[model samples]
Target: MPTDTRARMVTGAARMISRRGVDAMSLRELAEQEGVPLGSTYHHFPGGKAELVDAAVNHVGDRVAESIAGTRGQGTEHIVRWVLHAWRRILIKSDFRAGCPVLAAAVAKDERHRDTARAVFGRWTDGLIDVLIEDGVPPVRAPSVARTIIASLEGAVGLARAFGQIGPLDDVEAELIRLVAAAAGEPAPGAGR
Candidate 1:
Protein backbone atom coordinates (compact mmCIF):
# COMPACT_ATOMS: atom_id res chain seq x y z
CA MET A 1 0.00 0.00 0.00
CA PRO A 2 1.12 3.55 -0.64
CA THR A 3 0.33 4.38 2.96
CA ASP A 4 2.73 1.74 4.16
CA THR A 5 5.36 2.89 1.72
CA ARG A 6 5.08 6.46 2.88
CA ALA A 7 5.32 5.39 6.48
CA ARG A 8 8.33 3.24 5.73
CA MET A 9 10.08 6.10 4.04
CA VAL A 10 9.52 8.24 7.08
CA THR A 11 10.74 5.51 9.39
CA GLY A 12 13.82 4.86 7.32
CA ALA A 13 14.61 8.53 7.42
CA ALA A 14 14.19 8.64 11.17
CA ARG A 15 16.51 5.68 11.67
CA MET A 16 19.04 7.19 9.35
CA ILE A 17 18.88 10.49 11.11
CA SER A 18 19.27 8.75 14.42
CA ARG A 19 22.31 6.82 13.29
CA ARG A 20 24.16 9.12 10.98
CA GLY A 21 22.63 12.54 11.66
CA VAL A 22 20.69 14.60 9.12
CA ASP A 23 23.79 15.40 7.10
CA ALA A 24 23.97 11.81 5.91
CA MET A 25 20.37 11.17 4.89
CA SER A 26 19.48 10.76 1.25
CA LEU A 27 16.05 10.40 -0.33
CA ARG A 28 17.28 7.79 -2.77
CA GLU A 29 18.81 5.73 0.00
CA LEU A 30 15.63 6.09 1.99
CA ALA A 31 13.63 4.81 -0.98
CA GLU A 32 16.00 1.89 -1.28
CA GLN A 33 15.77 1.22 2.40
CA GLU A 34 11.99 1.21 2.15
CA GLY A 35 11.96 -0.82 -1.09
CA VAL A 36 10.15 1.90 -2.92
CA PRO A 37 11.14 3.51 -6.22
CA LEU A 38 13.02 6.78 -6.20
CA GLY A 39 10.08 8.55 -7.85
CA SER A 40 7.75 7.37 -5.12
CA THR A 41 9.86 9.31 -2.66
CA TYR A 42 8.94 12.52 -4.40
CA HIS A 43 5.40 11.35 -4.94
CA HIS A 44 4.96 10.81 -1.23
CA PHE A 45 6.96 13.83 -0.14
CA PRO A 46 6.35 16.75 -2.40
CA GLY A 47 8.97 18.83 -0.67
CA GLY A 48 11.50 16.02 -1.10
CA LYS A 49 14.11 15.48 1.59
CA ALA A 50 12.97 18.47 3.60
CA GLU A 51 9.45 17.11 3.87
CA LEU A 52 10.71 13.65 4.61
CA VAL A 53 13.08 14.96 7.26
CA ASP A 54 10.27 16.95 8.85
CA ALA A 55 8.10 13.86 8.99
CA ALA A 56 10.96 11.79 10.38
CA VAL A 57 11.72 14.27 13.16
CA ASN A 58 8.05 14.57 14.00
CA HIS A 59 7.64 10.81 14.08
CA VAL A 60 10.36 10.43 16.72
CA GLY A 61 9.03 13.39 18.65
CA ASP A 62 5.53 11.94 18.67
CA ARG A 63 6.83 8.63 19.99
CA VAL A 64 8.50 10.41 22.92
CA ALA A 65 5.33 12.40 23.52
CA GLU A 66 3.37 9.14 23.59
CA SER A 67 5.76 7.70 26.19
CA ILE A 68 5.32 10.82 28.32
CA ALA A 69 1.57 10.34 28.18
CA GLY A 70 1.92 7.01 29.96
CA THR A 71 3.50 8.78 32.94
CA ARG A 72 0.37 10.74 33.75
CA GLY A 73 -0.42 10.52 37.50
CA GLN A 74 3.05 9.16 38.19
CA GLY A 75 5.68 10.76 40.40
CA THR A 76 8.62 12.68 38.98
CA GLU A 77 10.98 9.81 39.74
CA HIS A 78 8.72 7.46 37.85
CA ILE A 79 8.54 9.88 34.96
CA VAL A 80 12.29 10.48 35.06
CA ARG A 81 13.12 6.79 35.13
CA TRP A 82 10.80 6.03 32.25
CA VAL A 83 12.19 8.74 30.00
CA LEU A 84 15.84 7.87 30.68
CA HIS A 85 15.39 4.16 30.06
CA ALA A 86 13.32 4.79 26.98
CA TRP A 87 16.18 6.76 25.49
CA ARG A 88 18.72 4.25 26.80
CA ARG A 89 16.98 1.47 24.93
CA ILE A 90 17.47 3.34 21.72
CA LEU A 91 21.22 3.38 22.31
CA ILE A 92 21.35 -0.25 23.32
CA LYS A 93 19.17 -1.42 20.48
CA SER A 94 21.06 0.55 17.89
CA ASP A 95 24.39 -0.69 19.25
CA PHE A 96 25.24 2.89 20.14
CA ARG A 97 25.27 3.85 16.48
CA ALA A 98 22.11 5.92 16.66
CA GLY A 99 21.34 9.03 18.66
CA CYS A 100 18.19 11.12 18.83
CA PRO A 101 16.57 12.16 15.56
CA VAL A 102 15.35 15.38 17.13
CA LEU A 103 18.92 16.18 18.07
CA ALA A 104 20.03 15.54 14.54
CA ALA A 105 17.36 17.88 13.23
CA ALA A 106 18.12 20.51 15.83
CA VAL A 107 21.76 20.63 14.77
CA ALA A 108 21.01 20.47 11.09
CA LYS A 109 22.36 23.24 8.88
CA ASP A 110 19.21 23.89 6.90
CA GLU A 111 16.66 26.44 8.07
CA ARG A 112 13.63 24.24 7.40
CA HIS A 113 15.11 21.36 9.40
CA ARG A 114 16.03 23.77 12.18
CA ASP A 115 12.44 25.01 12.36
CA THR A 116 11.11 21.47 12.48
CA ALA A 117 13.56 20.67 15.26
CA ARG A 118 12.38 23.71 17.22
CA ALA A 119 8.79 22.50 17.15
CA VAL A 120 9.74 18.96 18.17
CA PHE A 121 11.89 20.27 21.02
CA GLY A 122 9.03 22.47 22.25
CA ARG A 123 6.60 19.56 22.10
CA TRP A 124 9.00 17.39 24.08
CA THR A 125 9.69 20.08 26.68
CA ASP A 126 6.03 21.00 27.06
CA GLY A 127 5.02 17.37 27.37
CA LEU A 128 7.61 16.74 30.07
CA ILE A 129 6.74 19.95 31.92
CA ASP A 130 3.07 19.00 32.08
CA VAL A 131 3.88 15.61 33.59
CA LEU A 132 6.34 17.16 36.04
CA ILE A 133 3.61 19.51 37.19
CA GLU A 134 1.20 16.62 37.56
CA ASP A 135 3.78 14.84 39.68
CA GLY A 136 3.79 17.81 42.12
CA VAL A 137 6.85 19.67 40.86
CA PRO A 138 6.18 23.32 41.62
CA PRO A 139 5.01 25.14 38.50
CA VAL A 140 7.78 27.68 38.90
CA ARG A 141 10.37 24.94 38.90
CA ALA A 142 8.85 22.48 36.43
CA PRO A 143 9.89 24.28 33.27
CA SER A 144 13.48 24.75 34.40
CA VAL A 145 13.72 21.17 35.61
CA ALA A 146 12.19 19.83 32.43
CA ARG A 147 14.61 21.83 30.31
CA THR A 148 17.58 20.63 32.31
CA ILE A 149 16.54 17.02 32.00
CA ILE A 150 16.06 17.34 28.27
CA ALA A 151 19.34 19.16 27.84
CA SER A 152 21.27 16.67 29.91
CA LEU A 153 19.67 13.71 28.21
CA GLU A 154 20.53 15.08 24.81
CA GLY A 155 24.14 15.59 25.78
CA ALA A 156 24.37 12.23 27.45
CA VAL A 157 22.96 10.43 24.47
CA GLY A 158 25.46 12.11 22.19
CA LEU A 159 28.39 11.23 24.42
CA ALA A 160 27.23 7.65 24.79
CA ARG A 161 26.91 7.29 21.06
CA ALA A 162 30.29 8.86 20.53
CA PHE A 163 32.02 6.43 22.85
CA GLY A 164 29.94 3.47 21.72
CA GLN A 165 28.91 2.89 25.33
CA ILE A 166 25.94 3.70 27.54
CA GLY A 167 27.81 4.91 30.62
CA PRO A 168 27.24 8.58 30.01
CA LEU A 169 23.50 8.17 29.71
CA ASP A 170 23.37 5.86 32.69
CA ASP A 171 25.26 8.34 34.83
CA VAL A 172 23.00 11.14 33.72
CA GLU A 173 19.96 8.95 34.39
CA ALA A 174 21.01 8.38 37.95
CA GLU A 175 21.47 12.10 38.48
CA LEU A 176 18.16 12.95 36.83
CA ILE A 177 16.22 10.47 38.95
CA ARG A 178 17.71 12.08 42.05
CA LEU A 179 17.00 15.57 40.78
CA VAL A 180 13.43 14.69 39.92
CA ALA A 181 12.80 13.19 43.33
CA ALA A 182 14.26 16.25 45.00
CA ALA A 183 12.17 18.55 42.82
CA ALA A 184 8.98 16.77 43.91
CA GLY A 185 10.03 16.78 47.58
CA GLU A 186 10.13 13.00 47.68
CA PRO A 187 12.39 11.02 49.96
CA ALA A 188 15.66 9.91 48.38
CA PRO A 189 16.12 6.24 47.85
CA GLY A 190 16.66 4.41 51.16
CA ALA A 191 16.41 7.65 53.10
CA GLY A 192 14.32 8.03 56.25
CA ARG A 193 12.95 11.14 57.94
Candidate 2:
Protein backbone atom coordinates (compact mmCIF):
# COMPACT_ATOMS: atom_id res chain seq x y z
CA MET A 1 0.00 0.00 0.00
CA PRO A 2 2.98 2.27 0.51
CA THR A 3 3.72 2.13 -3.21
CA ASP A 4 0.18 3.09 -3.98
CA THR A 5 0.32 5.89 -1.45
CA ARG A 6 3.54 7.12 -3.00
CA ALA A 7 2.00 7.23 -6.43
CA ARG A 8 -1.03 9.00 -5.07
CA MET A 9 1.17 11.54 -3.38
CA VAL A 10 3.10 12.18 -6.60
CA THR A 11 -0.07 12.50 -8.65
CA GLY A 12 -1.60 14.79 -6.08
CA ALA A 13 1.53 16.84 -6.01
CA ALA A 14 1.21 17.47 -9.73
CA ARG A 15 -2.34 18.68 -9.29
CA MET A 16 -1.34 20.83 -6.35
CA ILE A 17 1.58 22.25 -8.24
CA SER A 18 -0.70 23.09 -11.13
CA ARG A 19 -3.10 24.96 -8.89
CA ARG A 20 -0.63 26.47 -6.46
CA GLY A 21 2.63 26.67 -8.40
CA VAL A 22 5.83 25.07 -7.14
CA ASP A 23 6.69 27.71 -4.55
CA ALA A 24 3.34 27.35 -2.81
CA MET A 25 2.91 23.56 -2.60
CA SER A 26 4.09 22.55 0.85
CA LEU A 27 4.83 18.93 1.70
CA ARG A 28 2.42 18.90 4.62
CA GLU A 29 -0.35 20.29 2.45
CA LEU A 30 0.38 17.72 -0.22
CA ALA A 31 0.35 14.93 2.36
CA GLU A 32 -3.00 16.02 3.70
CA GLN A 33 -4.50 16.61 0.29
CA GLU A 34 -3.27 13.29 -1.03
CA GLY A 35 -4.41 11.47 2.10
CA VAL A 36 -0.97 9.91 2.45
CA PRO A 37 0.90 9.56 5.68
CA LEU A 38 3.46 12.28 6.12
CA GLY A 39 6.20 9.70 6.45
CA SER A 40 5.24 8.20 3.12
CA THR A 41 6.38 11.33 1.37
CA TYR A 42 9.86 10.94 2.80
CA HIS A 43 9.89 7.23 2.03
CA HIS A 44 8.92 7.92 -1.56
CA PHE A 45 11.08 10.99 -1.98
CA PRO A 46 14.25 10.70 0.01
CA GLY A 47 15.57 13.85 -1.58
CA GLY A 48 12.62 15.79 -0.15
CA LYS A 49 10.54 18.65 -1.59
CA ALA A 50 12.82 19.28 -4.54
CA GLU A 51 12.49 15.65 -5.53
CA LEU A 52 8.72 15.72 -5.29
CA VAL A 53 8.41 19.03 -7.09
CA ASP A 54 10.66 17.95 -9.90
CA ALA A 55 8.85 14.67 -10.12
CA ALA A 56 5.60 16.56 -10.51
CA VAL A 57 7.19 18.62 -13.26
CA ASN A 58 8.23 15.48 -15.11
CA HIS A 59 4.84 13.93 -14.52
CA VAL A 60 3.08 16.88 -16.13
CA GLY A 61 5.58 17.17 -18.96
CA ASP A 62 5.39 13.48 -19.75
CA ARG A 63 1.64 13.62 -20.04
CA VAL A 64 1.71 16.61 -22.38
CA ALA A 65 4.51 15.09 -24.45
CA GLU A 66 2.44 11.95 -24.85
CA SER A 67 -0.45 14.11 -26.03
CA ILE A 68 1.85 15.71 -28.60
CA ALA A 69 2.94 12.32 -29.95
CA GLY A 70 -0.67 11.21 -30.11
CA THR A 71 -1.22 14.02 -32.63
CA ARG A 72 0.63 12.29 -35.43
CA GLY A 73 -0.99 13.11 -38.84
CA GLN A 74 -3.15 15.77 -37.22
CA GLY A 75 -1.50 18.49 -39.30
CA THR A 76 0.08 21.70 -38.01
CA GLU A 77 -3.23 23.51 -37.50
CA HIS A 78 -4.77 20.62 -35.66
CA ILE A 79 -1.66 20.13 -33.58
CA VAL A 80 -1.46 23.83 -32.74
CA ARG A 81 -5.14 23.95 -31.92
CA TRP A 82 -4.81 20.85 -29.77
CA VAL A 83 -1.96 22.41 -27.83
CA LEU A 84 -3.76 25.73 -27.34
CA HIS A 85 -7.12 24.27 -26.45
CA ALA A 86 -5.46 21.97 -23.94
CA TRP A 87 -4.23 24.96 -22.00
CA ARG A 88 -7.47 26.81 -22.58
CA ARG A 89 -9.43 23.91 -21.16
CA ILE A 90 -7.09 23.57 -18.22
CA LEU A 91 -7.62 27.24 -17.37
CA ILE A 92 -11.32 27.38 -18.13
CA LYS A 93 -12.00 24.18 -16.19
CA SER A 94 -10.13 25.39 -13.15
CA ASP A 95 -11.60 28.90 -13.44
CA PHE A 96 -8.08 30.15 -13.95
CA ARG A 97 -6.83 28.76 -10.67
CA ALA A 98 -4.64 26.06 -12.28
CA GLY A 99 -1.76 26.57 -14.68
CA CYS A 100 1.13 24.65 -16.17
CA PRO A 101 3.45 22.93 -13.70
CA VAL A 102 6.31 23.09 -16.18
CA LEU A 103 5.94 26.87 -16.22
CA ALA A 104 5.84 26.90 -12.44
CA ALA A 105 8.86 24.61 -12.16
CA ALA A 106 10.84 26.65 -14.64
CA VAL A 107 10.96 29.35 -12.00
CA ALA A 108 11.80 27.08 -9.05
CA LYS A 109 14.62 28.11 -6.76
CA ASP A 110 16.02 24.62 -6.72
CA GLU A 111 18.37 24.17 -9.61
CA ARG A 112 17.47 20.53 -9.96
CA HIS A 113 13.79 21.31 -10.35
CA ARG A 114 14.56 23.99 -12.91
CA ASP A 115 16.84 21.59 -14.74
CA THR A 116 14.08 19.01 -14.82
CA ALA A 117 11.76 21.64 -16.25
CA ARG A 118 14.35 22.48 -18.90
CA ALA A 119 14.69 18.84 -19.87
CA VAL A 120 10.94 18.53 -20.09
CA PHE A 121 10.74 21.63 -22.28
CA GLY A 122 13.49 20.23 -24.48
CA ARG A 123 11.60 16.95 -24.83
CA TRP A 124 8.43 18.82 -25.77
CA THR A 125 10.38 20.78 -28.35
CA ASP A 126 11.75 17.54 -29.79
CA GLY A 127 8.28 16.09 -30.04
CA LEU A 128 7.03 19.16 -31.86
CA ILE A 129 10.04 19.07 -34.16
CA ASP A 130 9.05 15.58 -35.21
CA VAL A 131 5.45 16.65 -35.79
CA LEU A 132 6.50 19.64 -37.86
CA ILE A 133 8.93 17.54 -39.91
CA GLU A 134 6.24 14.97 -40.50
CA ASP A 135 3.93 17.80 -41.55
CA GLY A 136 6.41 18.67 -44.32
CA VAL A 137 8.39 21.37 -42.54
CA PRO A 138 11.93 21.21 -43.92
CA PRO A 139 14.11 19.19 -41.59
CA VAL A 140 16.59 22.04 -41.18
CA ARG A 141 13.89 24.56 -40.30
CA ALA A 142 11.81 22.28 -38.12
CA PRO A 143 13.99 22.65 -35.06
CA SER A 144 13.90 26.46 -35.08
CA VAL A 145 10.20 26.59 -35.84
CA ALA A 146 9.49 24.04 -33.13
CA ARG A 147 11.44 26.01 -30.57
CA THR A 148 9.69 29.20 -31.64
CA ILE A 149 6.32 27.53 -31.31
CA ILE A 150 7.14 26.33 -27.82
CA ALA A 151 8.31 29.76 -26.72
CA SER A 152 5.21 31.33 -28.15
CA LEU A 153 2.92 28.77 -26.55
CA GLU A 154 4.55 29.08 -23.16
CA GLY A 155 4.53 32.86 -23.19
CA ALA A 156 1.05 33.14 -24.64
CA VAL A 157 -0.40 30.67 -22.18
CA GLY A 158 1.29 32.36 -19.29
CA LEU A 159 -0.17 35.65 -20.40
CA ALA A 160 -3.54 34.10 -21.07
CA ARG A 161 -3.72 32.65 -17.60
CA ALA A 162 -2.54 35.87 -16.04
CA PHE A 163 -5.35 37.75 -17.76
CA GLY A 164 -7.87 34.95 -17.34
CA GLN A 165 -8.56 35.03 -21.09
CA ILE A 166 -7.65 33.05 -24.20
CA GLY A 167 -6.84 35.99 -26.40
CA PRO A 168 -3.12 35.37 -26.28
CA LEU A 169 -3.55 31.80 -27.43
CA ASP A 170 -5.90 32.80 -30.22
CA ASP A 171 -3.52 35.50 -31.30
CA VAL A 172 -0.61 33.10 -31.45
CA GLU A 173 -2.49 30.37 -33.26
CA ALA A 174 -2.67 32.28 -36.53
CA GLU A 175 0.88 33.60 -36.15
CA LEU A 176 2.35 30.18 -35.41
CA ILE A 177 0.39 28.48 -38.16
CA ARG A 178 1.75 31.06 -40.57
CA LEU A 179 5.22 30.61 -39.14
CA VAL A 180 5.08 26.81 -39.57
CA ALA A 181 3.77 27.14 -43.10
CA ALA A 182 6.49 29.60 -43.94
CA ALA A 183 9.10 27.27 -42.47
CA ALA A 184 7.85 24.47 -44.67
CA GLY A 185 7.73 26.67 -47.75
CA GLU A 186 11.02 28.55 -47.33
CA PRO A 187 14.68 27.63 -47.38
CA ALA A 188 16.38 26.69 -44.12
CA PRO A 189 17.46 29.54 -41.90
CA GLY A 190 20.75 31.13 -42.97
CA ALA A 191 20.89 28.81 -45.98
CA GLY A 192 22.60 31.54 -48.02
CA ARG A 193 24.63 32.98 -45.20
Candidate 3:
Protein backbone atom coordinates (compact mmCIF):
# COMPACT_ATOMS: atom_id res chain seq x y z
CA MET A 1 0.00 0.00 0.00
CA PRO A 2 1.25 3.48 -0.80
CA THR A 3 1.76 5.62 2.27
CA ASP A 4 1.17 8.84 0.35
CA THR A 5 -2.49 9.78 0.29
CA ARG A 6 -2.55 10.76 -3.38
CA ALA A 7 -0.66 7.71 -4.56
CA ARG A 8 -2.86 5.45 -2.48
CA MET A 9 -5.96 7.08 -3.91
CA VAL A 10 -4.75 6.67 -7.47
CA THR A 11 -3.82 3.02 -6.91
CA GLY A 12 -7.13 2.35 -5.19
CA ALA A 13 -8.93 4.09 -8.03
CA ALA A 14 -7.18 1.86 -10.55
CA ARG A 15 -8.12 -1.25 -8.57
CA MET A 16 -11.70 -0.09 -8.24
CA ILE A 17 -11.87 0.79 -11.90
CA SER A 18 -10.47 -2.57 -12.84
CA ARG A 19 -13.40 -4.28 -11.17
CA ARG A 20 -16.25 -1.76 -11.47
CA GLY A 21 -15.11 0.71 -14.16
CA VAL A 22 -14.84 4.49 -14.25
CA ASP A 23 -18.53 5.39 -14.13
CA ALA A 24 -19.11 3.20 -11.13
CA MET A 25 -15.96 4.22 -9.32
CA SER A 26 -16.86 6.99 -6.91
CA LEU A 27 -14.15 9.23 -5.58
CA ARG A 28 -15.95 9.44 -2.28
CA GLU A 29 -16.01 5.69 -1.95
CA LEU A 30 -12.39 5.48 -3.03
CA ALA A 31 -11.37 8.09 -0.48
CA GLU A 32 -13.24 6.24 2.24
CA GLN A 33 -11.72 2.98 1.16
CA GLU A 34 -8.28 4.48 1.42
CA GLY A 35 -9.02 5.88 4.87
CA VAL A 36 -8.62 9.44 3.62
CA PRO A 37 -10.99 12.35 4.01
CA LEU A 38 -13.02 13.12 0.90
CA GLY A 39 -11.64 16.62 1.10
CA SER A 40 -8.17 15.22 0.74
CA THR A 41 -9.08 13.60 -2.54
CA TYR A 42 -10.16 16.96 -3.92
CA HIS A 43 -6.98 18.47 -2.58
CA HIS A 44 -4.89 15.87 -4.43
CA PHE A 45 -7.05 15.84 -7.54
CA PRO A 46 -8.85 19.12 -7.88
CA GLY A 47 -10.10 18.10 -11.29
CA GLY A 48 -12.10 15.41 -9.47
CA LYS A 49 -12.90 11.99 -10.92
CA ALA A 50 -11.60 12.71 -14.39
CA GLU A 51 -8.20 13.71 -13.11
CA LEU A 52 -7.99 10.73 -10.79
CA VAL A 53 -9.14 8.36 -13.51
CA ASP A 54 -6.54 9.75 -15.89
CA ALA A 55 -3.83 9.24 -13.30
CA ALA A 56 -5.03 5.71 -12.58
CA VAL A 57 -5.03 4.75 -16.24
CA ASN A 58 -1.60 6.25 -16.76
CA HIS A 59 -0.33 4.52 -13.64
CA VAL A 60 -1.42 1.11 -14.85
CA GLY A 61 -0.12 1.77 -18.35
CA ASP A 62 3.28 2.93 -17.17
CA ARG A 63 3.59 -0.11 -14.89
CA VAL A 64 2.82 -2.52 -17.72
CA ALA A 65 5.12 -0.73 -20.15
CA GLU A 66 7.92 -0.74 -17.60
CA SER A 67 7.48 -4.47 -17.02
CA ILE A 68 7.56 -5.16 -20.75
CA ALA A 69 10.61 -3.00 -21.22
CA GLY A 70 12.33 -4.81 -18.36
CA THR A 71 12.03 -8.06 -20.31
CA ARG A 72 14.11 -6.74 -23.17
CA GLY A 73 16.67 -9.24 -24.61
CA GLN A 74 14.71 -12.08 -23.02
CA GLY A 75 13.11 -13.03 -26.40
CA THR A 76 9.53 -12.63 -27.56
CA GLU A 77 8.36 -15.90 -26.02
CA HIS A 78 9.55 -14.86 -22.58
CA ILE A 79 7.94 -11.47 -22.91
CA VAL A 80 4.69 -12.97 -24.17
CA ARG A 81 4.59 -15.54 -21.40
CA TRP A 82 5.53 -12.97 -18.79
CA VAL A 83 2.64 -10.70 -19.79
CA LEU A 84 0.13 -13.53 -20.03
CA HIS A 85 1.12 -14.96 -16.69
CA ALA A 86 0.94 -11.56 -15.03
CA TRP A 87 -2.66 -11.10 -16.16
CA ARG A 88 -3.48 -14.68 -15.32
CA ARG A 89 -2.31 -14.20 -11.77
CA ILE A 90 -4.37 -11.04 -11.44
CA LEU A 91 -7.50 -12.87 -12.61
CA ILE A 92 -6.95 -15.79 -10.30
CA LYS A 93 -6.00 -13.68 -7.32
CA SER A 94 -8.99 -11.44 -7.69
CA ASP A 95 -11.24 -14.45 -8.29
CA PHE A 96 -12.32 -13.15 -11.68
CA ARG A 97 -13.59 -9.89 -10.21
CA ALA A 98 -11.06 -7.65 -11.96
CA GLY A 99 -10.12 -7.03 -15.58
CA CYS A 100 -7.94 -4.45 -17.29
CA PRO A 101 -8.44 -0.87 -16.12
CA VAL A 102 -7.41 0.35 -19.57
CA LEU A 103 -10.14 -1.74 -21.18
CA ALA A 104 -12.66 -0.42 -18.73
CA ALA A 105 -11.60 3.14 -19.52
CA ALA A 106 -11.55 2.45 -23.25
CA VAL A 107 -15.23 1.62 -23.20
CA ALA A 108 -16.11 4.61 -21.00
CA LYS A 109 -18.68 7.07 -22.33
CA ASP A 110 -16.44 10.03 -21.55
CA GLU A 111 -14.35 11.05 -24.54
CA ARG A 112 -11.50 12.01 -22.23
CA HIS A 113 -11.48 8.56 -20.72
CA ARG A 114 -11.53 6.98 -24.14
CA ASP A 115 -8.73 9.21 -25.32
CA THR A 116 -6.62 8.34 -22.32
CA ALA A 117 -7.28 4.67 -22.95
CA ARG A 118 -6.22 5.09 -26.57
CA ALA A 119 -2.96 6.73 -25.57
CA VAL A 120 -2.26 4.01 -23.00
CA PHE A 121 -3.04 1.27 -25.48
CA GLY A 122 -0.91 2.98 -28.10
CA ARG A 123 2.01 3.19 -25.71
CA TRP A 124 1.69 -0.51 -24.93
CA THR A 125 1.42 -1.41 -28.61
CA ASP A 126 4.44 0.67 -29.53
CA GLY A 127 6.50 -0.93 -26.75
CA LEU A 128 5.48 -4.42 -27.82
CA ILE A 129 6.32 -3.65 -31.43
CA ASP A 130 9.80 -2.54 -30.46
CA VAL A 131 10.35 -5.72 -28.43
CA LEU A 132 9.11 -7.85 -31.30
CA ILE A 133 11.37 -6.10 -33.77
CA GLU A 134 14.27 -6.64 -31.42
CA ASP A 135 13.43 -10.33 -31.24
CA GLY A 136 13.55 -10.69 -35.05
CA VAL A 137 10.02 -9.78 -36.16
CA PRO A 138 10.23 -7.53 -39.21
CA PRO A 139 9.26 -3.91 -38.58
CA VAL A 140 6.32 -4.07 -40.98
CA ARG A 141 4.96 -7.22 -39.34
CA ALA A 142 5.72 -6.12 -35.80
CA PRO A 143 2.98 -3.52 -35.62
CA SER A 144 0.14 -5.84 -36.56
CA VAL A 145 1.53 -8.71 -34.54
CA ALA A 146 1.93 -6.53 -31.48
CA ARG A 147 -1.60 -5.22 -31.86
CA THR A 148 -2.93 -8.74 -32.28
CA ILE A 149 -1.22 -9.94 -29.15
CA ILE A 150 -2.53 -7.00 -27.13
CA ALA A 151 -6.06 -7.30 -28.52
CA SER A 152 -6.18 -11.03 -27.99
CA LEU A 153 -4.89 -10.79 -24.45
CA GLU A 154 -7.27 -7.97 -23.57
CA GLY A 155 -10.22 -9.92 -24.96
CA ALA A 156 -9.10 -13.03 -23.16
CA VAL A 157 -9.04 -11.12 -19.89
CA GLY A 158 -12.63 -10.10 -20.49
CA LEU A 159 -13.64 -13.63 -21.28
CA ALA A 160 -11.89 -14.98 -18.26
CA ARG A 161 -13.73 -12.52 -16.07
CA ALA A 162 -17.08 -13.22 -17.69
CA PHE A 163 -16.70 -16.96 -17.35
CA GLY A 164 -15.12 -16.80 -13.90
CA GLN A 165 -12.29 -19.00 -15.15
CA ILE A 166 -8.75 -18.60 -16.45
CA GLY A 167 -9.22 -20.89 -19.46
CA PRO A 168 -9.59 -18.04 -21.93
CA LEU A 169 -6.31 -16.51 -20.82
CA ASP A 170 -4.56 -19.87 -21.06
CA ASP A 171 -5.89 -20.49 -24.55
CA VAL A 172 -4.91 -17.05 -25.75
CA GLU A 173 -1.47 -17.38 -24.18
CA ALA A 174 -0.76 -20.57 -26.10
CA GLU A 175 -1.90 -19.16 -29.41
CA LEU A 176 -0.05 -15.88 -28.89
CA ILE A 177 3.16 -17.71 -28.09
CA ARG A 178 2.72 -19.59 -31.34
CA LEU A 179 2.00 -16.41 -33.23
CA VAL A 180 5.06 -14.65 -31.83
CA ALA A 181 7.23 -17.65 -32.56
CA ALA A 182 6.07 -17.80 -36.14
CA ALA A 183 6.57 -14.06 -36.55
CA ALA A 184 10.10 -14.35 -35.21
CA GLY A 185 10.80 -17.35 -37.46
CA GLU A 186 11.49 -19.60 -34.51
CA PRO A 187 9.95 -22.87 -33.41
CA ALA A 188 6.86 -22.32 -31.29
CA PRO A 189 7.34 -23.02 -27.63
CA GLY A 190 4.69 -24.63 -25.46
CA ALA A 191 2.74 -22.35 -23.18
CA GLY A 192 4.48 -21.74 -19.88
CA ARG A 193 3.49 -24.24 -17.24
Model 3: lowest-lDDT 10 consecutive positions: 184-193
lDDT of 1 by residue, 63-137 (tens): 887777777777557766776777778788888888889989988989889898889888878988988887777
As a TM-score, model 3 comes out at 0.92
Ranking by lDDT: 3, 2, 1
Model 2 RMSD in Å is 2.3
Give a tens-digit lDDT track for model 2, residues 48-165. 8888888778888998888888887787778888888888888888887777788888887777878998999999999998989988898888888888998898888778878999
lDDT (Cα atoms) of all candidates against the true structure: 0.84, 0.85, 0.89
Better of 1 and 3 by TM-score: 3
Query: How do the predictions measure up, each by TM-score?
Result: 0.90, 0.90, 0.92
As for candidate 2, its clashing pairs are none
User: Candidate 2: how many backbone clashes?
Assistant: 0
Model 1: lDDT of residue 172: 90
Clashes of 1: 0
Q: Specify the highest-TM-score model's number.
A: 3
